[model samples]
Target: MKRSVLFAVLFSLSLHAFAIDTKLMVRAKAKDAKFVGSSIGGAHIIVRNTINGQILAEGITTGSTGNTGLIMKTPKDRFAQLADDKTAGFLAVVDISEPTFVRVEVISPISRKNAQVHASTELWLIPGKDILGDGVVLEIPGFVIDILTPNTHQYIPLESIKSTGLDVKANIVMMCGCPIEKGGIWDSEVMEVKAVVKKDGQVFGELTLANPSRNLFEGNVKIDGAGSYQVLVYAYNPTTGNTGVDIINCVVTE
Candidate 1:
């Protein structure tokens, strides 16, 4: 009789050890006004059962004007095995017995030119161990942009740009060097700027804005330098008006 009781108790504990709850959040946007090629502005959220690598549930959000958001939930144990893999990019994992929700964000850019202007959603997930029973935490220090110019007039400081739904605070630094002849220029007339969210200091999500060049430059600018420079962009809280800075570095070649 005692043996039967012990067996049942162990079985219950085993089942509880592998349980979990998960959630996801997502957003996306476009960079340029032209919106050329296969640039479909949309966001998708997914939850997978890590034990067997099976997709449990998925959701999507999209917009033509350039922004979207979504939320989802699932069991905690569904991703327990996946948490052990460093390359998995799992931000946070909850206890198998407790209810957990993992939030995810996906933001796609319209083009490489747009990527330079906004660089939206480039924040990465910085994983840490020994917390919440070996789970991951999300961190986003912000996005960075590097600009190379032929002269000081071409410099676009981060503080000069404007963003929707987020505040802008940026750090700009100039490196001394000579100018490059016809090498530091892009074909696009306008560029898009993007901002992504960071849980801890790593990028977890992003958003892109159209025609960022209007805010960055007042008139036609030229690049004539062979040095390096950096521009940082931060996620601003629209309600609080608090600004965060993202960083970008650029190299000009002669």
Candidate 2:
């Protein structure tokens, strides 16, 4: 125990002589797109000195674990896990001339299908500070939904068929102002969730959404009589007591 503490202290004193090594763990999630965090290529990642705005490092976040980003330093000691679940975790050394704060930026490229993603986070560090337990979580917030499915704004050919009910199914993504991991977002304190449905500008109906699975809300909406309609889906998360919304457009034939 004394040896570990002594080594840590000595390393702190040697900051002026050598770069301070540290590990940076991050999680990326896509709300309206897929793989933006775990598999959708990588983001234009960067770490900058918040004091001078000078960039410290550049890289991307990829792989199945959402870590695999700009890794500049290797851990001096082994790390078991950071939070409730273990993250593959991105690692950065962050060469420090003195103890200070730094910023992390991850901007995901435009999704081939849906939207874009960007993230900014800041953390304070001391030279030779412990970099293991729970570390800093650089959360990259992606879009709002994975895909509206069948896409939106569709004209069913004014005379295509004769169906009474319009069935709308979508896998909605809800972000509880939390971090992302393993195809999902964590940090919910609520037990009840609902998806408020709307047509045009008026409340149509509401559907109780099941527990989210893999960052998606599995729900459906049935509209009996339709004209030119705008379908809106609002996901209510009681956790932070916030609601996320998305829209779908469709035209029903006469």
Candidate 3:
């Protein structure tokens, strides 16, 4: 009886020791742009076991954003590899005794809080199997919009608002930190940027923002002797249906 129990314990230990290293590559790609990589403070990656709520691996991606021509110009075929070895990716190697299901989460452009995107997916990871070469691309949809004028929670006098009006200016960029310019890659002309104004929680008007230079949109909002004003600036790409927004609240004191 003692020998049998000892054998059982040893077998169990052996079985548990038979763990294999599984590799998984995760990449965060902008909706209409390149991959989110080191230049833009690479994406934060988290890998967790769904069953036990245990974290397997966590780190940030490091590499280039990826090739522009291959990602933007080339006609992609099914299973065509768009990312090369230099492209940014977070490779998580987890040791597992059996097939385990995991949830992968990615927060991209980690440097920009206002433009960060959280995306996740679940998949089964087989022991000893590796997923690489453009594996599990998470698409982040939106622009990074920052309101440059009329700072949040700022105070302005009503006289100044009625005299010169509020100059609305914003800086907008892709999730990958790609620049939006006129007649260039990621064209600004194809995008529509505007500021939605509100006074005392009521709709005031909308101001169309025109691109004066690369990644800069400027416009003027006419305030009706403002009370409490809220400005919501947004960038929309109708072609790809990608959009982003930033908001600010300013008090127009008498």
Candidate 4:
């Protein structure tokens, strides 16, 4: 009898050790394109243990469909996860003792044959407990520019960027002779410009570039809505015509 009781106790503990709860769901859309070859409409999910920087689990799904659900387990009470949906992509989850930070990367693939073949990645985080009331969501949109030297000036609207959550500060970085400005001409209504620097799509640092200029401006701005933002960078001289402006990096810090 004693041996049987000990055996049952150990078995119960072992089952509980590996139990996991689904914490996040991700979705992707391939706009203006069809789901072709393995290279297109393909997506994957990855989970990581944030505390020790170890990967917990990973899997793949189809982007042509709707949202793909991802579940992960935690060793401790506090945890974080990063999710990416693209070719050669992964999602990561992390565990932290205190309030910690993690990174998320979303890659939008464009077809060389068709510039309109744009891919967008969306992520959602589901909390396990009610410790943090009304969890915050941050969003950052991606952009691409194709310009020909000598007379291809274009103004990419910042409103084209998209995100699902709040608390995301936008950061802008650019090269020389790129005229990047943000603000409204009437009553200071021009949308505020935020700066974010990201590695692998996860936000590391943030600043606000309100009515920013070419001086590498940085500051903090509050996000009022949840959606896409267009990142605009133009040539200071229209006569120079069509100099390419690259939005080298962006990040969201919460």
User: Model 2: clashing residue pairs?
Assistant: 31-145, 32-145, 35-40, 73-93
Q: List the global CA lDDT of all models.
A: 0.30, 0.51, 0.91, 0.31
Going through the candidates in order, what is the number of backbone clashes in each? 54, 4, 0, 34
Tens digits of per-residue lDDT, candidate 3, 1-254, equal 99999999999899878998989999999998999999989999999999998999999989998999999999999989999999999999998999999999999888888888899999999999999989989999999899999898999888877868888889998998889999989998888889999999998989889998999998997776758888999988899999999999989888
Question: At residue 94, what lDDT does model 1 achieve?
Answer: 26
| Model 1 whole-model lDDT (C-alpha atoms) | 0.30
Best by TM-score: 3
Q: Each prediction's Cα RMSD?
A: 17.5, 11.9, 2.6, 19.4
Task: Write candidate 2's Cα lDDT for 92-138 as tens digits.
Answer: 66666567788877665424223345677888766677465445544
Per-residue lDDT of model 4, residues 155-197, tens digit only? 2223433232222222222211112344311111123334443
Best by lDDT: 3
The residue-by-residue lDDT of candidate 1 on 12-130, one tens digit each, is 98986665543232323222111111233222434444445444445443222211111102233644421222221222232334332323333222222222222212222222212
The alpha-carbon root-mean-square deviation between model 2 and the true structure, to one decimal in Å, is 11.9
Instruction: Quote each prediction's TM-score.
Output: 0.25, 0.54, 0.91, 0.26
At residue 244, what lDDT does model 2 achieve? 49
Candidate 1 vs candidate 3, TM-score winner: 3
| Rank list by TM-score | 3, 2, 4, 1
Q: Determine which window of 10 residues in candidate 1 has minimal summed lDDT.
A: 172-181
Which has the higher lDDT value, candidate number 2 or candidate number 4?
A: 2
Model 1 error, position 248 (Å): 3.1
